[model samples]
Target: MDLTPRTAPEAAAPSTRRRWVPLLVLGLVVAAGGVLVARFLTSAVDYYCNVDEIGERAGCEKGRSLRVQGTVEDGTIERTDGTTSFVISFN
Candidate 1:
């Protein structure tokens, strides 16, 4: 007679992925949030410049954000397509 204890086959245990899924999702969210905040801060930093000076400066090329201060010429304001267009005079 066999004296060894007998055991039946058991179902496979759950995977480790179930435990790590929440942590993985949280990490991704934090990383994405950090990227958004960094972009907002960098893009928000702007320099002041006049329209006349922008043409002469090489660093004032396209894709650069600047605050252009000038006086709009009188009688040059026009409204079209829900947009206001005007000529600014920089002296």
Candidate 2:
């Protein structure tokens, strides 16, 4: 081949595409992870409310798991072989 004088020996800056590609990929991964974590945390969170306020409160919607606070009434506790069920009252 032809001989040319080398002014700069591999001392050039890296191209913009090579540098920004990884950074862009990392940013997208982080955003996706954040969205997944947020959805998981929100789904794991349960609604807490009083027994009497089940239908009146926004967090006490039916068919949803809830942490209801109430006083246990006597004679309502039933202990079966594998389960113990009871009734509670707020008033």
Candidate 3:
């Protein structure tokens, strides 16, 4: 009787190779999705508006998204239906 092992069945079976194919495909898909999401988020436009800049910078076209910062004016807050809107004042 020989004591040599028969190459340990080639380190992996054919069924295992097929299984790894799907795993490799899934990993590639996830990597591509992440890259696409990152690119989309980075390419998106961002606008910033300060309290003083709002009045000074006019001609802002309608339907443009913006971020505004200011202090709420006294006696100018109005609330309705669980939502609140305020008039901001900047010195």
Taken over the whole model, the C-alpha lDDT of each candidate is 0.86, 0.91, 0.76
Clashing pairs in 2: none
Tens digits of per-residue lDDT, candidate 1, 13-54, equal 878998799999999999999999999998888867788878
Position 36, candidate 3: lDDT: 97
Residue-level lDDT tens digits of model 3 in 1-91: 9998676545555687898999999999999999999999876755677767754675333456667767899998999999998897665
List ranges where model 1 is wrong by over 4 Å.
1-37
Worst 10 residues of 2 by lDDT: 5-14
TM-score of each: 0.50, 0.74, 0.42
Q: In order, how many clashes per candidate?
A: 0, 0, 0
* TM-score attained by model 1: 0.50
Q: What global local distance difference test value does model 3 have?
A: 0.76
